[model samples]
Target chain A: MEGNIYKKLLEELELGNKAVMITVMDDKECGEKNCNRKILYTEDNIANSCISDLNKVVYEKAKQSLETGNLEFVQVNETESYLIEPYFPEPRLIVFGGGHIAKPLVEFGARAGFLVTVIDDRPSFANTARFPGAEKVICESFDKCFDLINLNRSTFVVIVTRGHRHDMECLREVLKHDTAYVGMIGSKRRVKGAMEQLVNEGYSKKKLDKVNAPIGIEIGAVTPDEIAFSIIAQVIKYRRLADGKEEKKILSKVNWPEIDRDVLMELCEEDSLPKAIITIISTKGSVPRKAGAKMLVWSNGKVSGSIGGGCSEGEVIVKSRYLLRDREYEVHRVDMTAEVAEEEGMVCGGIMDVFLEPFWN
Target chain B: MEGNIYKKLLEELELGNKAVMITVMDDKECGEKNCNRKILYTEDNIANSCISDLNKVVYEKAKQSLETGNLEFVQVNETESYLIEPYFPEPRLIVFGGGHIAKPLVEFGARAGFLVTVIDDRPSFANTARFPGAEKVICESFDKCFDLINLNRSTFVVIVTRGHRHDMECLREVLKHDTAYVGMIGSKRRVKGAMEQLVNEGYSKKKLDKVNAPIGIEIGAVTPDEIAFSIIAQVIKYRRLADGKEEKKILSKVNWPEIDRDVLMELCEEDSLPKAIITIISTKGSVPRKAGAKMLVWSNGKVSGSIGGGCSEGEVIVKSRYLLRDREYEVHRVDMTAEVAEEEGMVCGGIMDVFLEPFWN
Candidate 1:
């Protein structure tokens, strides 16, 4: 029976299937007149022994088996013992660009243990000579290449094509799959435009939301290497999170209940007074408010702080609840000039970009 | 003078030199009349801040400067404080293999932000195609390539060559340089043969000792990916150790100096000892003693424990001092049947291995 079990486990492991093994030892066999010893093993050869005294013995055996890449079972009788192993498929990085940044990104991604594949419509850019470390280089349009590759949760798609339109084209295809990560490199304006286009094309809001537009953590990165650092950092963050490991830095700040409630209450109180509180969490281009700046709102809906504010606040307040609900905290550029910012009747002269996070109790 | 200093600092950073940034602030800058602030920023952009009442303001500015990758110096006499930016070069990984394992290792190394270079004798194996992720791939004999690469304290070298001979040849080259890590992959016999050859070659025992033969933590690795896992684990361990980070493993029994001494004394006192304690810290090949195993040496000097006693124990004991000095310990093997073992002792049959560590105090 032990031999049969061992053979079965070996088969599964060879086939790359995940499985666990259990062994039970009868009391008599355990040197305990009436007690039984039990052990469990995984296909990975991780073993757990129920008998504390037999732990060292079983652990050594398990380790030895693991070292030899073998799966086996030994009967201790009555007490159960077994091994468990989980098969993890290799991870792959599907890059949709072969530009300057893509060069280092691919090299780094490959070196980091991801089976990297670089794709470009231009044959010159997507050649083996150009991407020597890339596991595979495809000189085909993103649309056509998507069909040739198999993507899954372990697949990471980086859409860093030459332009926003190309980036969007790549993102549209990537979003259709269950990719572990989908990041597109673009300016804030370009990202917004691409997102709007995707949303208009009837892509599910949920899928659109999953895309990391203007990819990479906000590090004010300018150079290719610096940008690569930001992208890799974000990837590492996601990988850690997926593995249930603690991330070195908090990717997104938690929206404390009390803070959310307080901010909401303040906004509500000012509703009757015609004032607004403007909080800025981020900024881009020529924006007045820096990230994390806040302004108080007053009666008659006159705002003290800016979202970039002139005409941007009234609509902002309407959408603020959604941002609060979704926890989509980010910087917004609000036009304060009445002509540009005043869609309704109220116009603030100064432009302020506000990052309003809902304060809830 | 201040401008000159700032310019010099900027130049160093731009040239990718390593440096730390320090910032000092006065009371008013931190929003408190009497409060002061000081901050330190490392190359990785990890910041340590000291602030009083004006913590929020100072933190914001410090973070901004760090994000912008700017290093500077500023002074505010009365009302406000200034910020400083510093630049530091990233670390580099010097790999010695150009094999299948090197593929992922190089890829992962790049992704992890290491300046990676692959060195292999086979031009086909070391070319851009095989190691695209490698910033530079040197196609030269392993021994010759060492002359071209500069190995500093920060450089990490991983040896996963095609065979043991190549590994040994590469290791010898790296052993002469100041490196953060030197990991070699091989089986027990291969490792022993390589080491023996090195010892016979007149290489200083101390320098050769730094190599992590059978490199990687013993995690029961079998597959190439798993082997990669082990190698990476060792690399990470070395990196962390070099960075002064503490490993959290339970202290080894051998590491306990008092206990080791007690065991030695007890063995010495035994008029008719039944068992001798022989500790084998390392081993290679078809030897009776395995690394980390403890054996009992009989009173007749007839050993029951093996330390691959052949010729490895003397070195093991000398090296064990590292753990012993720190009051940290581990077990090792001593084989008494080999020529060296026979020359040194009164043996019992196959091999006489003993644990020479001190017993529990």
Candidate 2:
């Protein structure tokens, strides 16, 4: 009976089905000469056997299976034991380019228990030595590599090549596949150029929209490792989205009035209160916030949102007021490294480019 | 003057101080004839000034300086902006062992901007080639390495050695240092054995109390990488604790009534109503929750917490009742890879181990 139940569970799991099992045992049967035992398996429908207090046993077994993703057997007295096998599948990481960033990417990905694979046209770049953790390293062109690997919905694709052209070639091929995530590393201008080239090549704008160009949420990443983090973070975000998990938003859930046309016009007016607008254009490394995450500070102690909290925010606040007083529209770059942000207890080693502009009446 | 300010900020930070700078700029001095120009540096005990209205200018300058960690300033503003350079020290990750896990540890630490270093006797494991991003990797015995590296009041140490003896060796070395955190991975038996050995070696109870043995917050991590994550998480927790940040507790903070002696005795009675206890022992790969996170199920469709939500939880719920009916304690393992976790919408590729036991009356 246990063997049959295990076989059934394995079959359902392999077929991508869910199930729950319940066992009802008689306590008196344990000490009695001839006692009957009953076991029930509930796949899509409910299955039961002749047992005292059947409803209670069935309800519990069903609920237990549902709550813990486990299978078990329950006796009438709730004291016997049985086994249930759960179905789980392996994870895979599909990297598009095999470059310097990809080198660490493969290693980290493999160490993270991702079935890693590397693909590149250049055999020198894509090889076993370059990516030891990569299960398969294919020395095929970008166009052919897609066919070689099964790019399913479970696959995670990262495009880190020599330059924009190769990145675009890989992106085009990956976009055709049913991949869960697709990330390409490049500058905003470069990404824009790549998009235009793809559009010119007759790829649909809808298909292009699926790609995460300038890949990774903008953290103003400069180093290869930092860039890799941004890409990985984006991939994780995509996974959460695919799984329907809500990503934590920096902004509070408060009901802020939308910016009106009048407010915009007033802000643009020449004769308005001189306001220092400090906008974070980009961020890299261990920054408190990502590229688009912002903090607005007024000449007064009033503040909104944050680039990073603690000392970083306080320092930015002081600078904004100075910019306002001096009437200077200057750009400042802040590097948050161990040596710099340490006193503030910030370990995010990131560099942020902030543009401070004066808008006044 | 710049050197003096730098020296002052460093001194203040060394004493674990916090200060805010206010800059008040003098606009009239720059454009007016025979106008007095000045700059001011103010602290709690001292107020030094070179000119009037220097507060605004210097404050702005200091704020920008603080952002970039560039303490020096160029005279871009005619008003002479005051730059505030707040001294902030970065957090450090002091890894006690250099093994397979340490390779990823150094990579993650460097990318996360922690001043990472590996201490191991094996030269191959602690070489620069293995840990390129690590600020330092000391290939020395545990005792010698502890003396060489400065374990300050904010250092986070993680012990991941090949065996219990090495873990004990490192633990002994660290106990004397004024480190913020120390985490070691092993089974309860191994941890108890190590602690016994340490006690026998004359280590004080107070010092042993500081170590988080059988660590990683009780998460049932089986694989090396999973164990690495659990250890890293604990280190991160301690890092936050050092910064006075609250660590997020996994279980919901619930209010429970104090039980009287009579109530406790009554609860333990044999004829009392039976209860069901469900615990998640271990999880693998991309499961929603890590191991050791659990939930309890009652007969009335009521539930608390979760193992992994969705169809997986639904299955667990079903099996729970069966265990209650059978009056049996059973262990169930579920693998929810590729298949959706019921309607909870989690696509985690992993296996989960759950134990169902009858709650004694």
Candidate 3:
């Protein structure tokens, strides 16, 4: 049953649809109410859920995760614990010119988890050989690219055409799209001229305001690669969704591909036998990895993920097997500051408290 | 003479001294007064120069470059063309706590060209084994770190300690240093409380205003790595000296180490051979490398710097040798958009205009 639910989740993800998965972790006191159950939530509001009252919490958490695109640990009514993970579509980076800056931009964009697309009027400029990382290479006029690709809120567009003529044409098309970020690279005069023309043509000043003209976080980036770095930095800045000031956003853990795939698959399996899962709950001073890094240990000593693979993990692994024998949920303190840490051939010099919990069907 | 200049320059850099180098690239009409010349500019005002008028321009450029550490191309009196390279001491990054965020910050700081140091009271938290990239790792009390290391205007300090008490203590120490940037990580309330305490202790509101509290650019970065990215991004934004809206800075090419060292070394060589050097002056559309990239071509087919090593370079290399035969200074353009670019097993899909300059000592 969990497999079918996960299959749907993966399918929705592949289709570029948004979703949230809720997995129950603890049900020690909630007898026979589908303890340790799984639920799936989507934008359609039609979801696979269990245990009333907990479903309301899942719905609220699911909605919140959609905004942040984060994974969360939710305490469902104090007795039920659920881990809610959001699934956003692969981020799209649409480049409106296959220019010099676009070269490194595409490379950086791809490396930063964007499905990059390069659009140019000349076939020579937009091709696979130059942009191997680009998901699509559209060699068409400036206006044609808009009609070709789907530009939605998830799409990040960078306009860096060769001339003002091409830049103006692309600006027209970009304004029409429902996009997340729109950055145009040009001199102040060039960008202003393009924007003024668009405004004169009846486009709202508010619409033009959306564009990050003279694009990027000004890093004194002069070369194409430097400019590329600045542009990507700005994109990440926006994607990270920074509030103006003094707003300490509660950050979600890293969107680990390994965890999304491997852990999800493992959890979906119909393994009635219990398995110990270790999560770094707290940390201090020079830890190799951060909190949110997880490691799953089996009774047989096999493992998945890493809590900074060192003597600390070796100790945790031994303790995890012991945990499996006792079947007691415990918090294991790993202190890697002693001389033994150096002797173990590790560089970590911090203390971490890991919560070891076993999951059973 | 050039070697002594560079050795002095490097030594001054190690000592955190600021200086600038002005190199005369071309002077076709300036009589027999050395076509390729080098000049040094420092606060001592000692300079070995040919054109006194050009010396004024060098001084002005040097002063501006000092404010923003950047390499500039200066044209003096429309006749004396020079490259003014600014040399400041390696920017120092001093981390007050060797915590999770410090790990990635150290790695990123090293990659972004900063001499880093990690300081903490716990020997386990602050050690060489954890921070291989750090120039110094001080395992002492937070207050003791300041007395251990020299904190000058070129230093950037980040405080991310285990406790608010330690963070405040580090902040108090940091405020005493003449620093470039100061950031402290904590909740807004924590930072406010620290600042209030400092204000009560007679620190001016203006002085406390400089601290980037709750550190990092508002990227809702939660994980240590993500938070590190935001902090570094903010550091760069400040370092690059963004002057806010409409003042789009004219960025120079990337401070390429190879170009800086090789070109400087090559110019310093006493060889009187009329060597033809190729410098990428301008580029457009999908070129492998950016403008300001160089390729020093000798009389033979040997080359030093790379402007994307492919068939495009092969063509440039061939053209470079041809220019050497005639010993003529010319701007030879290489258009890689043609079909030949593909046939040459090349990936470049842009045009590059290279300045082929012949240097005669």
In order of appearance, the predictions have TM-scores of 0.32, 0.39, 0.58
Q: Which runs in model 1 stand beyond 4 Å of their true positions? A: A1-78, A243-361, B1-361
Residue A141 lDDT in model 1?
79
**Tell me, what's the RMSD of every candidate?**
35.2, 36.4, 9.0
Every candidate's DockQ is: 0.01, 0.02, 0.19
Kindly give the stretch of ten consecutive residues in candidate 3 chain A with the minimal lDDT sum: A242-251
Categorize the docking of model 1.
incorrect
What lDDT is reached at residue B147 by model 2? 67
> Model 3: per-residue lDDT, tens digit, B1-361?
3454655665565555567766675654544423455566653453343446466776677666655555566665556666666666667888888888898788667755678999888777788999998999999887666778867656788888777888888888778765778899988887888888899999888778888899987655656766776777666655555322113453342242222446546654667665666666667777766655667777766677787776778887787778777655565778777623453213547888776666555
Candidate 1 chain B, run of 10 with poorest lDDT: B250-259
Interface RMSD values for all candidates: 22.2, 17.3, 5.7
What fraction of the reference interface contacts is present in each model, in order?
A: 0.00, 0.05, 0.28
Candidates sorted by DockQ, descending order? 3, 2, 1
For all candidates listed, what's the TM-score of chain B alone?
0.47, 0.47, 0.66
lDDT of 1 at B184: 84
lDDT of 1: 0.53
Candidates 1 and 2 compared: the better one by DockQ is 2
lDDT of 1 by residue, A51-148 (tens): 46455655665555432323334444334443311223345788898887888778767655678998998876889998888999998877788877
Per residue, candidate 2 scores C-alpha lDDT tens digits across A166-249 of: 777778777776665777877779889888888999989877777777786544443465556555545544543332112232
